[model samples]
Target chain A: MEYIKEPMEIEERSFKIITEELGDKVFEEREGKIIKRIIHTTADFEFADITVIHSDAVEAALEALNGGCRIYTDTKMALSGINKKKLTQLNCQVYCLVDDEEVAKEAKDRGITRSIVAMEKALTDKETKIFVIANAPTALFTLCQQMKVGEVKPYLVVGVPVGFVGASESKEVLLKQNVPYITVKGRKGGSTVGAAIINALMYMIE
Target chain B: MEYIKEPMEIEERSFKIITEELGDKVFEEREGKIIKRIIHTTADFEFADITVIHSDAVEAALEALNGGCRIYTDTKMALSGINKKKLTQLNCQVYCLVDDEEVAKEAKDRGITRSIVAMEKALTDKETKIFVIANAPTALFTLCQQMKVGEVKPYLVVGVPVGFVGASESKEVLLKQNVPYITVKGRKGGSTVGAAIINALMYMIE
Candidate 1:
């Protein structure tokens, strides 16, 4: 898809659904400069990987895709940008936090499917990862639970969640599932980031 | 566990907290107000739920907990709030906005997680209740995916993430998840609104 060159900047982070003659793609502009662009392509390929100039750009791109997509974020800035609302809204089940059950619940309520387990809630190996994503301290009991349950496989978890409150926890949930899946390298990856990663993976598999 | 009382105005959404002082129970502001100062007793609940006087009070309360707490806003507000470095810096997440992978990623990078679901992804039965929160029309697909997945559980995966782009997708994700959740009661909800609801649930649960 081709993008028009008229870049606009807004102090608040927001999106503009600019349509291009070639196709529909998302772009990020800062101070009249097009810092990033997420091109929307046919999902003919399985996996795809794209670079992000700014974290917000990732979310913009992800917002334009279909469902059943997973996502990942590698940076705290990107993760927090998405927020709990975004995560919950995006149907995320995992979240990584830095606090207690209250924090975890808050993250979960915000659409973070999974959350980091706190020091107080850690129980087994599985819990360790959950806690990590939740951004909470790891515990022993959780580790034990995973050891007993064995690894969950063929995990059909979606990560393209917009909320980053529990991005860490979401990732950990996938990890605890003990399945091979796609995820963004940083913590702020959005629906498109997940889509791109999955798209890239699908390409590799195909 | 004890609180001291300074003369404060009692409102609809007010409560009180009790603290032990010199072997005697003391009453402090837990949430509401009593007609007069009374020695706190075990029969009195330690914490009380205050009646909310102003609609904006909800947003104010959310802002007060913005630092690292999970929050949910409507989609419009969620999108507008993206790229807020200071707010993003907090270890919290927003569950509003529908899933727009691009926006989701960008918001994450900016420390904002606007809720959304991409249009290029797939959906399955197991992936019920979770959706890409976003604007109208496109969010329909997200909801369809949840219905196909047999999302029977009420509120389990529901969110009304408000704000701009991915508000629909965020809410769709929650519906697909089929897990118990909370959101604003009326049409006023957006993608981020779900996040706010989730935040409230977290607070209540905590």
Candidate 2:
């Protein structure tokens, strides 16, 4: 009693391997752009990047924002992340949520960034595509689920949860999502690279 | 009797205008990457760009070459296009058809650049995804039909042919073909820009 589906399964697996290998092979010849590898832990971290790729992604993100994707993030973090307050200065509407309770309130009071008491509420009803790069897989998992069901669509997910174990687990979590995505393909992602990917994605997705 | 599609036609006609205006409104804010533009008309075309955008297109061409897309051009313009001897130095593979008479011999020669016969052969291969750019719609039309029936796949036609008057028409030919493609919208497209769009698409697709 041989199973007829085995051949189909084998063929499908072969196709996937071909596609993956074919795609990876092209990257070898790809020049001009740079990809930096990073390794870090929960103990200490510092740095930033704001480059985007696939230029269209940046255009799409800006369109989404104009169409009602509200900005939601910590003011200091966002500013520190990009090294500028001009992002907040951009007239487009945004909902900021500073991680610091006091700064969050002040931002909300001053209308500098949209402030929210809960992470869930802050990330909800936004028009911009969400980009998450967490240091913990659990954090990324929670954030991904929130964005998956939230108003914002994800253009790309950077599964670079830093620290010793989180990076690998983060990749696993993203792979489980079963969507068309691009990643660094290893456990070399950290806060800087994750932010760099977002910056690049934002640039590309805009 | 009312035509059901008239409203859609009118709306689409208006949509282009609205979209153009809106794009202008945000264009300053976006400040997208601008590849150098070139308007070539056989003669008086001086210099070529070797930017990252151009790199992408060349890489794609290289891949096609690796997978059997033959290189071709008018034999009369061969020695002037690029240092042919230098190209040969790169040492992958080469084919040529010197002028109209020796074209057959040149194709048989396999290492020279001057080619009139290979141009005819390349133009006639319908299976070839002839990625072209310029203002000549007629050239593309003739090339399309000449390239054997059922050989030229529909979507393989990337109508980035861009230039003065005929560019829009060339694009329309591709549009009529109803193929998946990528092209710069509005007035930003020229010969270089057209080529750049192909490069950008190759980056995204491959």
Candidate 3:
């Protein structure tokens, strides 16, 4: 008899390889899921070492996804990485302000980053529960400042912007924020990581 | 008088910030373009330190783009980051194998990475001039291996897979390859970087 594997089976096998490789590192329920997804996305095991997930981050993100809360990302790459078809079933929509003309104009007018302006616009919607910042540290910094001033409160913040400038600094602010969050310490995060966390939560919700 | 900045102006301003931040480094004619685009894409300056570009990489990539060569990437993010509209004008198309069911099947059947199988499939087309491996070191390794065996001879290889595993090793292989290449040494790259290089070349082609 000949054996055949489907695409889904291949993906499962890939996950198995990841789990076997991860062995004994991430045993926590939520942390394990997020880490697994990150590894799956990047095929990089270093994430297991760098990723810092708030104990309640997965739960908080799951709740938001279940409640059909609006999802926002700082980069279109994150926006594109998310499984929109799956989210649509739950009546959730993903938004990215980085490419918005209005956000760009506002950023220019206020002498701020477009991501900051997009975050400001997202705050207009009280239902915005999840924030994924994957590219710009300035956006993450602005979010922390806004949260500090009680301008907005989100259920979960995925702060994973990659860079040398303010990536670590902004993530430090997120770590200090009184909110459920998932971040990679230092300067090693990208839209792929951000989307992986969200996708992991989405997969776990069902 | 009040001044209004258009979207293009804002983009220019963003580039200016990147250039100012990148100061004193990367002033070369070609290297500057690639580095600027990487900074523009990720808002990261450290890329200037990590990225290693062959002196003729940009020239080779530009030639391929002008000749309407096909672009191949390991991830969808890289595929999405590329300026498809611009590539279309040059009669070039981008290919990503990770999402293809056939490629997945081949990967499973051969017990090889899907990206590797994708690269193999891509090699079937002699016109595939540019290769971008953004998220998988295994793909880069496999490409280098195939290139060694005379299976494929891509005009330019943009090898920027980020990870603790095989990332640097595969990039080292790329560096040793007798081919025009752009790679970031060690573990500091992703789909964004891969796409930025291609987009930079596309912009330069025009």
Candidate 4:
């Protein structure tokens, strides 16, 4: 019935357990940090096998964070889960347009998911270098369409939308493209996962 | 690459697929609604097997919602994911005290997690009949401790805190108690899950 009493102690103990559970499997340090954090956040070890981080993904995200680039997430929940202390220290900004007046109106007019409109609106902001789709596959599909047409090429795409419909399929499409990205391979991701990925990258920014 | 365009269509299609994939299993209408909604939210079918709903859990929650009872969640992300329209329709309020100035000062002074302090502070509000712990095991533990001492008796406790440290352990403690609760077995739950359960119950509220 006894438990770790201190917050820092709890977190530290969690990381240690993650390491022990992971065993001696080697990981490129930067990528390992992200996957480990995701594991820490979800307590789901499957992420170690399914998480896909492009060779250049960590470096690209780090560059974007250091440049003080903006971030756009599909869900406000994702926006809330991202670490604010690090964001404040980096002087970077994160935005979620799902609640935006224009985005809501546009989606209603078009009879489409607000995710589609939100993605389009986020793309218009030139400083937005990171596109995080944690809850809506439609948003990932939109980002992919933008990338394919050469209308937008974000520095990093954290695509971890969770759903049975287009969630896994959209990430499969993202993997084949030349875009620098990080994602989970199946229907096992969410707002927390997306935020964890971005926060891990922010911590890596030096 | 073509997918469902309209938001309603996408959701409808997703629900249809979930039903198809769920196969020949039968669940009580009320329990099925919450479980299906969880599956819909996470795209993870494992919930159908892992989700635990006490017999009185749903009814207790429904009665509390009808009474315009308050909700206290451990994380802001969970607070964001809960459906506002339904909550407003029910005339209920949801609060997350992790960011409260008094909570921060108290936790810092006590050298414990804000979750523990937040749960303690929330217990002070007699209207807070539903406790949702999505991202904090310490919060669930604190609630269980209070329940053990007969200091508080919430109508329902949504304990889905996801982490490696004490997430699953705290829920185990909750399971041992006589409190009405809905939780996921093992280590598979999160803020999204917590919000999904609440929103599902809200939708089901008459």
DockQ of each: 0.02, 0.01, 0.17, 0.74
Clashes of 4: 0
Candidate 4 Cα errors over 4 Å, as ranges: none
Chain A only: give the TM-score of model 3.
Answer: 0.93
Candidate 2 lDDT at A135 equals: 35
**Position A190, candidate 3: lDDT:** 86
Cα lDDT tens digits, model 2, B74-133, are 212111222233344433222323334565466446533222234455556444543443
- Sort the predicted structures by lDDT, highest score first: 4, 3, 2, 1
DockQ of 4: 0.74
Candidate 2 ranges with C-alpha deviation above 4 Å: A1-79, A83-98, A102-118, A147-152, A178-182, A201-206, B1-206
lDDT of 1 by residue, B39-87 (tens): 1100112112211122233343434344354333324333332323333
Taking the tens digit of each residue's C-alpha lDDT, what string does model 4 give over A1-206? 58876989988888888989999766898899999999988887889999999998987888889988889999999999998989989988999999888989999999999999998888888778998999898999988988998888889999999987789999998998888999999888999899999988887866
Candidate 3 on B71-122: residue-level lDDT in tens?
8888888887787679889999998878789987878787767777787777
TM-score list, all predictions = 0.24, 0.29, 0.71, 0.96
Question: What would the per-residue lDDT of candidate 2 be over residues A6-76, giving only the tens digit for each residue?
Answer: 22343344334333433433322111112321111010111113122333434455454344434443222
Chain B TM-score for all candidates, comma-separated: 0.32, 0.39, 0.93, 0.96
lDDT per residue (tens digit) for residues B158-180 in model 4: 99988888888988898998988
lDDT of 1: 0.30
lDDT, candidate 4, at B54: 93
Give, for candidate 2 chain A, the lowest lDDT window spanning 10 residues: A39-48
* Stretches of model 3 off by over 4 angstroms after superposition: A1-56, A65-70, A83-128, A136-153, A161-178, A183-189, A199-206, B1-27, B39-46, B84-91
Better model by TM-score: candidate 2 vs candidate 4: 4
